[model samples]
Target: MPKTLDDELHTAGAGASGRRERAASVPRVAWLIGPALVAGVAYLDPGNVASNMTAGAQYGYLLVWVVVLGNVMAWLIQYLSAKLGIVTGRSLPEVLGARITNRWGRRAYWLQAELVAMATDLAEVIGGAVALNLLFGVPLLWGGLITGTVSIALLVLQSRRGPRTFEFVIMGLLAIIAIGFTVGVFIAPPDPGGLLAGLVPRFADTNSVLLAASILGATIMPHAIYAHSALTRDRFATRRGGPGARRDSGDPTRRIAWHGFGISRPADEPAPAPGTSTEVPTGVLVRATRWDVSIAMAIAGTVNLCILLLAAVNLAGVEGTDSLEGAYAALGVALGPVVATLFAVGLLASGLASTSVGAYAGAEIMHGLLHVRVPLILRRLVTLIPALAILWLGFDPTLSLVLSQVVLSFGIPFALVPLVVLTAKVGVLGQWRNHWATTAAGVGASVFLIVLNGVLLWLVFTGA
Candidate 1:
């Protein structure tokens, strides 16, 4: 049989495990960083840069709290995603596909999910292309072609180096982004009092509210929601390769660990069922995964915060500076060419890392929803055509980035509702199911997203 997403992830994860064995002196906390970091890349993609920068420039530090709230919500969603994978051993798409029995229903889901994936790829491609244009003065059309090609090359490289190495490369790029923005933040520090005040949460107007929705759309990506589950489940299975690999429930020790972590199987999913068992303690994995997600997301959150702060300090009240390129040039004038160049370089890093992730999510969505597997290069090509078309048609690159985020906001409900519904179910998740508090939070987040989308629509039509 051809390898499924789960199969490939397991193989790659096992390879990572072998490398871990060779470097036995590495600390325990180090092992859990891969999945979370990989998934967290979505939070720092070009769409986020545009949204956060726009927010800061237009509203000063007023919208910082939205970013904070969005990241906190993302932490919860991603943790649930990791738990779902670890316990059920399926990606979100796979689970969605299995539960919806109607053939047409599945196809409809696939169509919308594919559109969401494309919107995701669109942001990554254009974001990277804009970076190249800023750095090298390349034309946007040619820049997009180069971005698509290089991103696929990175994907191919990841396949060759194995999952762990691929993760390290992403982390390396993330470090560049962090350092770049951190420098920007320090060089042009916003008011400490204003920064503290920004965290109190107040929308300046409908436009600010629109930007908040865009930031939310960018922060908690639909693709990352699907990808995290596949990543965590497969990596754990690969690392714990042994007999009874699937029979994880029999280990009373593991069950206690899960309970200790505030996770439990539902009454319906009793341990030691005829065919279910676990290789290692699920609770240990849960605890480790939580730490991994917490650290990775915290880093991501900080980076996003820095973007908004930098923009507020440098770009506020600057006319005709709504786009990334505009912001880059404005920083050059305000700070110097060096700071602007660093900003471009960080944008480049964000573009490359995120586009690669977008490809992975595209593949998982295809496989899970359609039961069809396409080559990664082919999928990259499919997503590239639309981006190239956008550039070819003379659309502004930065405007394209913002508009793509709007489409993503429209798609959020489709992904979030199903996730919340499934993760809250006892039959599906057993003791690993979300508790009452989590379920409430998940529901509230879902409603928040929907309301934001509604406001976006209202703002678009009313021009308010």
Candidate 2:
């Protein structure tokens, strides 16, 4: 029989595992630090740039608390998502797909998830177009087309080269993004007193509240939550011995294990004798994942803060800095053309890296939920059309980016609520189930996000 995609992925994962075991002198944790970094790209997407930059330019440092709070919540949320995949050997969508037996009900859920993915692609494509126009004077529509094409190339890299090579490429772009966004903060430092005050968590008014919601929306992305699980599953999950290894006996415990990191045990497996080493390989990878998630989140959080601080120090109260192009022009006037050019370069990198990841997440959503696979070219073209049409219609890119994030914020509960519930359930994760404290934190974060979105709607609708 021909190998399926899953078989290929499992084989690749197992090969990586074999290589890791052979090189025992190196830290195993080092080998396990990649999936979260790929998912972290979603946090630094163009919607994030628009929301954080707008907040800083319009409200100064007043909403810094929002950005910080969102990252903190994101750490917990993403860890839970990855944990679900690690423990169950399945992505959240796949788990849900199997459990929700009703066909129409499954289809309905897929629709909403599909919409969230489309919204993510919209922000990414528009951001790329804006970057191209700023850097090379390309027309927005043409720039958007270029961005989509490049992203298609990236998807090809992921498919043909397997994920490890793709991770290296994305990480390279991540370095460019980090340098591009943060160098300005060092050149023109933010006020110490104002920056400290922004951490106190008080809102100035309805407008500040609106910006806060946008920041939260951008920071804690739904697609990132979905993608992290699948990424980890692809990297870590496999049969006990290897991809096609068979059980020596009828015992189920010997039948299942996460290749490389012996995480999962089949439900029917017997317990080891008391004298045997009680430690499972799951702990090693889980600990490594903590380091992975922490490092990724720290980098994402810092870059995001630098973006806000860059605007607060250089563009606050400056007229016409509300949009990205305006912000680019303002950065040139205040700092220099060098700083402005770097910002555009970073934006371009962000757009290219993130849109590719977003497309991967969308593909996972479809395959996991609907149990169907579409050609990558067709999937890319379908999602690319709405973004290109928006550019052709001449809608303001920055505003569209911000609104797309709000749409993401609304989709958060659907992904998050299920994650918390499943991770808390002993049936789903067995010994690896979430501790009460972790579940409480997840619940609190989900509630906080839900309430903030409600307040945003109320203020907008009531004209407060």
TM-scores for all candidates: the values are 0.86, 0.87
Model 1 residue 350 lDDT score? 90
Report the C-alpha displacement of residue 350, candidate 2, in angstroms.
0.3
Give one digit per residue, the lDDT tens place, for model 1 in 254-281: 4221111122233344444332322234
Q: Can you give the lDDT of residue 445 in candidate 1?
A: 92
Worst 10 residues of 1 by lDDT: 255-264
User: Which one is best on lDDT?
Assistant: 2
**Local distance difference test values of all predictions, in order:** 0.79, 0.84
Superposition-based RMSD of candidate 2 using all C-alpha atoms, in angstroms: 8.1
* Model 2 ranges with Cα > 4 A deviation: 1-27, 240-280
Q: Return the lDDT, model 1, position 439.
A: 91
